[model samples]
Target chain A: EAGVAQSPRYKIIEKRQSVAFWCNPISGHATLYWYQQILGQGPKLLIQFQNNGVVDDSQLPKDRFSAERLKGVDSTLKIQPAKLEDSAVYLCASGAGAHQETQYFGPGTRLLVL
Target chain B: SQQGEEDPQALSIQEGENATMNCSYKTSINNLQWYRQNSGRGLVHLILIRSNEREKHSGRLRVTLDTSKKSSSLLITASRAADTASYFCATGARGAGNMLTFGGGTRLMVKP
Candidate 1:
């Protein structure tokens, strides 16, 4: 089986510019998540989706960040008017929606905002 | 806020030695998982230990969880240069939307 897949492994953008990242999760996985990992820090959950429905997005910056999992297979995360603080690795993961199931992660999209 | 915190932000050891990393959490959790990332790539799941379980072993990796103390330890036996990577501990709680809260990772460098 194929693992989760992401596009544009690395991205460089200027502050105030917009950027978007895409993620295609593993087949049959119902839970998809987006996380941000700043340098020297652990990944912080930005949003989570379960079969096209958002499970949680309390940490997402509503003013600047938004994500959607339309059709529930692939998802996209976008940041408009990006800021320097938004420079971080964006990771996407998927799981089987079980309490004990392990999540599979994709090669993250590293964004560098200047 | 991050739920878990790993100790010893960085560790360096020679090959063939055992490497131990510790993680402590603030709230109750259903399970704790350990992952390894190589050169900023995607993270690979190493091990997972449930709250009801005390210890688990997978090949050279051993994980011990102490719910009473809300701490966990990971031991890599006879470490190799290939084991050099950043290790992170993630906690899954019952009320935390089933999302894993990761701790700041510990960077381990195994010298040959």
Candidate 2:
């Protein structure tokens, strides 16, 4: 089966500019997630969606970041007025509904804000 | 605030040896998962152990959980140079949404 897919494997932007990342989850997956991974650090959950509905986004930066999964199959994450600190890799993952279901991840989009 | 924290930021060992990594969390969880990442690629799920379970094995990988202490450990036996990568532990808490909170991860390097 095909795994999660993401676009623009690498991105370069200037501070204060806006950038967007896209994700296409595995077929029949019910849950999708977006995470940020800074250099030398683990992924940090930015938001989660269960069938186009947000499940959790408490850690997301409301002032600058937003995400949406309109059809429950594909999702997009946007970072506006990007800051230097926003330089990191954004990863997307999908999983079935089971609580212990294993998640499949995409190659991720590496963003470098200058 | 990060829910999990991995010990030993980095580890280096020779091929054929065993490599172990530990993780600790602050909250109660229903299950814990381990994932591996090579270079800049996305994470690959390795294994998962429920709270009621103490140990699980998959091929050369072994995971042990201690709910009482809110900790888990991953052991990779007979490691190979190809096993060099970063390993992260994620926790799924009950009623805390299905999202997972990951730890800083442990970078393991197996030299031939």
Candidate 3:
């Protein structure tokens, strides 16, 4: 079976610019998530969605970062006015359910802010 | 903040040797999982041990959880060069749905 898919494996933008990443989860998966991984650090959860509805986004930087899973199959994460600190790999993962399930990850988008 | 923290930020070993990595978490968890990430790639789940389980083995990998100390360990026996990667331990905390909090990761290098 195909795994999660993401677009634009790499991206570069100037500070204050806007960048967007897209993710297509595994077929039939019901939960999707976005995570940010800085160099030399583990990925940190940014937002989570369960079939077009957000389950958790408490760690999301609502002031500049936003994500949406409109159809529950694909999702997008956007960062407006990006900062140099935002340079990191953004990963998208999907799971079959919202409990005790394994998460499948995409190749991830590596973003660089100049 | 991350709930799990891995020890020995980096390790180096020759092929056919054994490699061990440890993870400690701060809160109650429903399960702990280990993932491997090759440089510049996404993470791949290795193993998951539930709270009620004490040990699990998958091929060359063995995982042990000690809830009393809130720590878990991953042992990879007869390691190969292909096993060189960053290992991360993630905690699925109670009431957190399916979300996982990952640790800083342990970088393991196995020489062929």
Candidate 4:
């Protein structure tokens, strides 16, 4: 009955540095997601994974941002050459299904890029 | 980009008063959900209303959805200081595999 868990509640990095965040979803949840929430804005979906396969990542910045859900349970999101604008909160959520299910979110990783 | 927009970006009211927040979307959706986010914390799901359903209630929360107008509203009865937080409305578009597009969110401050 544990909720989604994330690591490194906060991070600070310089521009062009690489940063990675980790997420472990709730047990038995098949759908996992990563979202970016900028200050004063709603969360923007960065990528989604159903099991070990990616369901969607249209908004992901392919040039520098990448994520993987290996083994289909825990996932990681990485951003290389981070930009100052990338300073925002990274949230991870897990759902029981891909449709009509409630998504449980983690505390999120707050990344501050200098 | 955000698909939904919330009205009155910020609202302040005394505790024990009703708090109402409205959201409008631009596309077809399967369901609409509301979430509350405390300061520096992740979002917590409040309620979900399907496109076919008009209204739903949980505890002191009431949600109304109007598909024809593509709008929804959330009402918190007898609000408390604990209710102070950012409220967001998210839409699950048809055929989008339940990916949600969230609105900018409404910052509500319930004073005690």
Candidate 5:
């Protein structure tokens, strides 16, 4: 089976600018996740989707960050007025279920904000 | 708050030797998983050990889980130069709303 797919392997933008990252999860997977991995740190969950409905997004910066999963197949995460601290790898993962399932990850989108 | 924290932020070893990385976590977990990342790229799943299972093996990788201690360890036997990468342990906790919390990771360098 094909793994999760992401676009724009890398991107660079200036601070206060806007950028968007896209994710296409594995087929038949019911759970999708977006994680931010900062340098020297592990990935942190930004949002989670279960069939186009958000399950968790408590960590998301609602003021500037917004995410949506349309049709529960393709998802997009956007950050308005990006910050230097936002420079990190955005990882997309999919799993068969929210629990007791292994997750498959994509190559990720490496974003750098100057 | 990160639920998992790995010890020995980094490790350097020679090929053909065994490499061990430890992870400690707070609260109960349904399982623990090990993942490897190369060059800051996406992580690749290595192994998973359930709360009830004390140990699990996949190829040259072995994972041991001690629920009593709230800790786990990953052992890579006969490590290779290609094995040089960052290894992380994530805990799946139902208490944390069924999310997997990852550790800071252990950077391993294997010299051939």
Candidate 6:
């Protein structure tokens, strides 16, 4: 059983630049999520999708952060005009259903904005 | 706003010792989960306890939930050096649809 996959494990970019992170969830998983984890803090959800449709994105920064889980298998989180505050690890996770069950996570992308 | 907060931001103990961490939440929850994250890695689910449940044990890990106080505890007995990592507690509420509110995390260091 393959776990969730994400890339570029590490990214370094300048402030105001655009950065994009990709995620490929586990096979047959139905739900996907994107979370931002600042240093020394827990992950904060940015967006959630259930099969190509957004389930929740209330915490997402609409001004510069956007995410899409097209085809219900892969997802991409984009942070445009990135600020230094955006320098955090972006994690992607997947679950079997829309319940509080086990969730598999990817390696995560560590973004460092200068 | 974060729903839970873990005590003892960091802890260190020799191998074969017990490691106990606490998590306190703010509101009612449908379930609570614990995850471990190694240095520079993603989180791995360790255990999950439902609202109706009080205690669950998985191998060397034991979890207890007290809804009355809205708090939970994770006990790792005879922990090994491999157990050195950051552990986080996450809470799930009704109608959340799988959303998890996590705590700041407790860093555990087990010396061999």
Weakest ten-residue segment in model 3 chain A by summed lDDT:
A95-104
TM values, all candidates: 0.97, 0.97, 0.98, 0.98, 0.96, 0.97
* Local distance difference test, each candidate: 0.93, 0.92, 0.94, 0.94, 0.89, 0.92
Candidate 4: clashing pairs of residues: none
Which digits, one per residue and each the tens of the lDDT, describe model 5 over residues B64-98? Answer: 99999999999999999999999999988664235
For A37-101, candidate 2 gives per-residue lDDT tens digits of: 99999899999898889988989999999999998899999999999999999999998655625
Predicted candidate 5 versus true structure: per-residue lDDT over A1-114, tens digit per residue: 788999989999999999999999888787888999999999998998888899899899999999999898989999998999999999999875446357788999999999
| Candidate 4 lDDT over residue span B75-109, tens digit each | 99999999999999999876635889999999999
**How many steric overlaps does candidate 6 have?**
0
Off by over 4 Å in 3: A97-100
lDDT of 1 by residue, A3-97 (tens): 99998899999999999999999998888999999999999999999889998999999999999999999999999989999999999999855
Model 1 chain B weakest lDDT span, ten residues long: B91-100
Could you give the interface RMSD of each candidate, to one decimal? 2.0, 1.9, 1.5, 1.5, 2.3, 1.5
DockQ of 4: 0.73
Q: Which pairs clash (backbone N, Cα, C closer than 3 Å) in model 6? A: none
Q: Report model 2's interface C-alpha RMSD after superposition on the true interface residues.
A: 1.9
Candidate 6 is graded, for docking, as: medium
Q: Write the per-residue lDDT of candidate 1 for residues B5-109, one digit (tens) a residue.
A: 998899999999999999999999889999999987989999989899999999999999999999999999999999999999999866524789999989999
Here the TM-score of candidate 1's chain B is 0.96
RMSD of 2: 1.1
* Model 4: how far residue A23 lies from native, Å: 0.2
Which should have the higher DockQ, number 3 or number 6? 3
Displacement of the residue A49 alpha carbon in candidate 6, Å: 0.6
Stretches of candidate 5 off by over 4 Å are: A97-100, B95-97
In the range B1-112, model 3's lDDT, one tens digit per residue, is: 9888999899999999999999999889889999999999999999999999999999999999999999999999999999999999999866634789999999999999
Q: How many pairs in model 4 have backbone atoms within 3 A of each other, for residues 3 or more apart or on separate chains, i.e. clashes?
A: 0
lDDT of 6 by residue, A1-114 (tens): 888999999999999999999999999888888999999999988888888999899999999999998688899999999999999999999986546377788989999999
